[model samples]
Target: MTETAVEQFTEHQRKRGKRVSVVSPLDAPFFETERGSLILGDCLQTLKSLPANSVDLFVTSPPYDGQPKYGNGEKYERDWYRDFFMAVSAEILRTLKPHGSFVLNYRSKRRGAERGVLQYEMIFWLREQGFLFCEDFIWGKPSPPPGKFNRFLKDAVEYCFQFSKTNDWQFFPENCLSPARWDAKDRERRKKLAHNYVRANAPSGQGRKRVQAGPDMVRPSTLLHLEPEFSPNPVKHPARFPVELPSFFIKLLTQPGQLVVDPFGGTGTTGLAAERLDRRWLLVEIDPTYASIVPTRFENGR
Candidate 1:
């Protein structure tokens, strides 16, 4: 008997001290690697096949309702879009581990002279479905497209809404700390303020007390500054987020070898980030064209 590619990959991972547990629920994956699998299917249906409490983290940027540039020629209405994702969210709730996290990268589309409230509506709907609303992180695009508008400034940010199955979700703030922004002079000032506070609170008879400067690295804020990155391939997906976007959440919410899933796996950006971080991933992409690029991405070491 010969070992299949997936079996070989699984065994290889196990020998390297990684727990290989993510498996394709479908008959076979469109593409498979040592650290991930890409399944070509409608995510709504495929996600339902995954066993309950299987996925550790879900990171994805779903297609906006009327955006047909994603190779889908049809434009979906707002109500249909909401219903579609609500069904998807129900499955996510079922598939996610009790302590797992779901990070949705989304932005509402603008209609005529006013901005749509779809993003907020989705948030409210998700909470109603029993997903605990965690925190909303903003992805600030430093290099927004150059344009002038009559009634609005350039759209410079998108929302990354974090949700969890339970309050006891796994989160490692230390893993996602950023370097302290203050310089030497600022540090000295902060130290002086801390010392003054300690001295003022202590009695006159007490010995003089010292306060240490703050940590060199501080916890990251909800706002993240990440410039969008283009795909190295000439034929690129219409919408692809920077790898840093998913990498941050993967580091904060998951451990090595845990399973991470991206339902709307456009060009496999989430899988790429997960693989590099030593986490297993399962990606479901409906478009075959976008799905074809994923294996090449991994093969070319992008």
Candidate 2:
């Protein structure tokens, strides 16, 4: 027998032996810890209850267009991309503060030699939702999934689209600085030319300053090289991103005590990253069992 959504919520609370404050009951706050809260429900529905402009940063990777089945993850038709993510974008834009940033990761799908357009379509749609197209980063995975066909070149990259509510948002480039890899000869050349000033063409009404060999600092680039070794024994999640992935964005876009959100917290990777960085988090997962995995994964390393 199928229980109603309200009935199921009440039953879940009773089974868990905890009292939850209820208003409409569609959205249920499943658990809370020192670092953050976890909600067990559909993100689209649960996100509706959050206050407007309350979140500081959002680091998430929604299920891509042609992903395999996972717990409680739906399989939308090919034509469902635009409307589905548009609704989600509107909600995310609402919860995001004027100075908030959203970093989204989407993978490119291939059907034989054909390429998918969901990732590009999402960028345009999110922009229409008033999110400024901040930047497009590539996660260059030297080691991609095994078992590739000969029809297409081995896929080795995924897209991370960074967006903001307005043109301005919180960002700390210093937080995720990449290690410098300058060659010895280049370093020596720069040192020899330190006293020399390199001039550039000045634009109209703009004065150009001479380029100097400033501090040998390295800023993170649009291409992120995050490649982790795969283990035969992984967690139950079918599509769990590495903790470092979200951690990079969390440190780059947010600060301590600021609120972070993951509308698609598969195995709570984002939440764990936020917790480690002293940022408050809100994770919304649709599957009860998967949502149940978050606390255990966070409190004790998995």
Candidate 3:
């Protein structure tokens, strides 16, 4: 947009009592590439401009309920978090397509070296918002964060809470299938058997392997074993997640050319994944510096 157009747009928003600073990206700094857009601004406010039921998938990790770990995150207690998510999620529910999926990756914060009920309280709040508790998965961190407190060991896992508008949301399980588990020695025995199975392991512990044929196939478990990524120039963002992490869900939950959104854009991991998977993405990052890093990532992500 032209400078004059931006000025006109800014003036128009001011007449409606909306703060232009929070919406500056609507004019100039809002950028778009072939596969995605990188908007530098508050996530909740940006959702208002998007059309309803436009997004096919939302794969993001919020501010850990306003924890102090991230630079912009504020330390808030359970009650505050419950209400905060209630507000932000209403926008998510609105923009999400009828069969879209909202994948929230979040973990509870520790308080004074002790555990709290923040995670539970927040889950209850999400459920109350009329979002279906579709399925809960674990993001298993192979390398956990160092323990600084006395109460617990190193933090190794976090929840990937899947929320759907309804139970009939899109899910392509075949996209995330894992290699079938088969012992090298057992392969020869399998060639002679049809629908091989160790029926002796049943509850009765007496059933034989006499069933029909079964294929050598398997799929990923609810537990996703992915680790954090290391960038030579991580810039100001230290907790950058790997691109494969988002790619997994993008492939499973969305099809090519569909819209995918990441409210907490971070290092543009989700956006890059969307690009590789032939999907379009809309990403928002509150920190301008982090948001600035997104475009370059699409060009030379390494």
Q: Please report the candidate that would top TM-score against the real structure.
A: 1
Steric overlap count per candidate: 0, 0, 2
lDDT by residue (1-302, candidate 3, tens digit) is: 34543454456457656676534676644546677787767787888888999999999876654456556556555655666556778889998999999988877766675666676666777788888888888888898756675656778887888889877899998888887767766676775775665556668667766543345777789889988675654446745677887898898898899999998898788999998889999898777656655555775754
The TM-score, computed over Cα atoms with residue i paired to residue i, of candidate 1 is 0.86
TM-score (all chains, Cα) for each model: 0.86, 0.81, 0.80
> Which 10 consecutive positions of candidate 3 have the poorest summed lDDT?
1-10
Best by lDDT: 1
> Which parts of model 2 are misplaced by more than 4 Å?
1-28, 71-73, 188-217, 228-235
Model 2: per-residue lDDT, tens digit, 108-194?
577666887778878888887788999998988877777757877666788889999887798898988776767777666765663
Pairs with steric clashes in candidate 2:
none
The full ranking of all candidates by lDDT, starting with the best, is 1, 3, 2
User: What is the Å distance of residue 255 in model 3 from its true position?
Assistant: 0.9
Sort by TM-score, top down from the best: 1, 2, 3
- Candidate 3 matches the true fold with a TM-score of 0.80
Model 2 lDDT, residue 256, Cα: 92
Per-residue lDDT for 1-302 in model 1, tens only?
Answer: 11343454455556556666645446677677788888877898999888999999999998876787765676666776678888999999999999899999988888989888888988989999999999999999999867888889998989999999999999999989988877878767776674444543456565655665567899999999999875475545766888999999999999999999999997888999999999999999877667666665776667
Off by over 4 Å in 1: 1-26, 191-196, 199-203, 206-210
Model 3 misplaced stretches (Cα beyond 4 Å): 1-23, 76-80, 184-216
